[model samples]
Target: MQNDDKYLKSKNENPGSGMPIDEMHELDRTLGFKERRYIEELRILTKSTAIDCIIDDRFERIIYVVRQGDMGIAIGKGGDNIKKMSRVLGKRIEMVEFDEDREVFIANMFKPAEVASVSFGERDEPVMVTVPERGDFGLAIGKGGSTIEKARILVRRFYGKEVGDILIPNRGNL
Candidate 1:
């Protein structure tokens, strides 16, 4: 995740809107040219504003955190929008509906995995995620650990925290 600085945080402006830019952290302000293009493209194609975008080259994926309530529109019926974006960008596209609550947001990041609970750690400590089943554990972690890695990078980027572990209750040898 060395190039995670390219994980751009949206500046809350339209491409052509002549609005004043809001304050952003120095780290959040380091969007690369390609990331800016991706963000703009997301807005144009999906008609949904992406709050953050992570260009994960290792997995050849583009992870977008879209504004809450925009997930359906972004994905479109039968996932047509995602399919189109994937074809256009030459990369897998994943979207997480943004949430203001850190715990809920972390849980949402593990979508399709049935997260049982999210336990937040104290300052600078890693958070713990509990899934309902062993199958959920595998799904949340993903092939070659890609899903969990993406979650870890994004949690650190957006929440300034880490995901210490993802586990299934009453399961052993995972």
Candidate 2:
């Protein structure tokens, strides 16, 4: 729940890339070193309210901590930061913000793709996200199932929730 505890928990849950980042030896760890430096670099370049940078099998998505009313500064002026990061990292870059509320957090994860609703199932089960339209389906799920994996990992890390699936209604049927 505390800031330090959050990163520690995040490192544990997101083992694919989190590594061991503790208050004592963050810079000593290779993964921690790289991530911290990258985050700083992003901050200097974008001057945004970034929380952290998550590197996953799919691509990198920078997480920011924007205030509730303000739109995210995650994407810099005219998306310049995103473009530069994409060129520098050689991977598609996505952005999301951290929220105290899990439902809002889930909505942030699937940004640009409007979420109609979000509800949790049984404990230790998946969380469901409803999108407004079918066209947003692919973007919510990501190419090759990567985005959903990112969502699941982050959910587990941040909220201790494991997402089994992000279901989209069949607009064709309607």
**TM-score of candidate 2 to 2 decimals:** 0.68
Q: Considering summed lDDT, which 10 consecutive residues are worst modelled in model 2?
A: 21-30
Model 2 whole-model lDDT (C-alpha atoms): 0.59
Once fitted onto the true fold, the runs of candidate 1 whose alpha carbons sit more than 4 angstroms away are 1-29, 172-174
For candidate 2, write residues 1-174 as lDDT tens digits: 113444333443432223333422223222366567666666666665445556664454544333333344557679877788777766667666766566787787776678787886655466788877777777788777666777776676554566755556764321
lDDT of each: 0.75, 0.59
Q: Count the backbone clashes (under 3 Å) in each candidate.
A: 0, 1
Residue 97 displacement in candidate 1 (angstroms): 0.9
Relative to the unseen true structure, what is the C-alpha lDDT of residue 1 in candidate 1, on a scale of 0 to 100? 20
TM-score of each: 0.81, 0.68
Question: CA lDDT of 81 in candidate 2?
Answer: 77
The residue pairs that clash in candidate 1, if any, are none
Index of the highest-lDDT prediction: 1
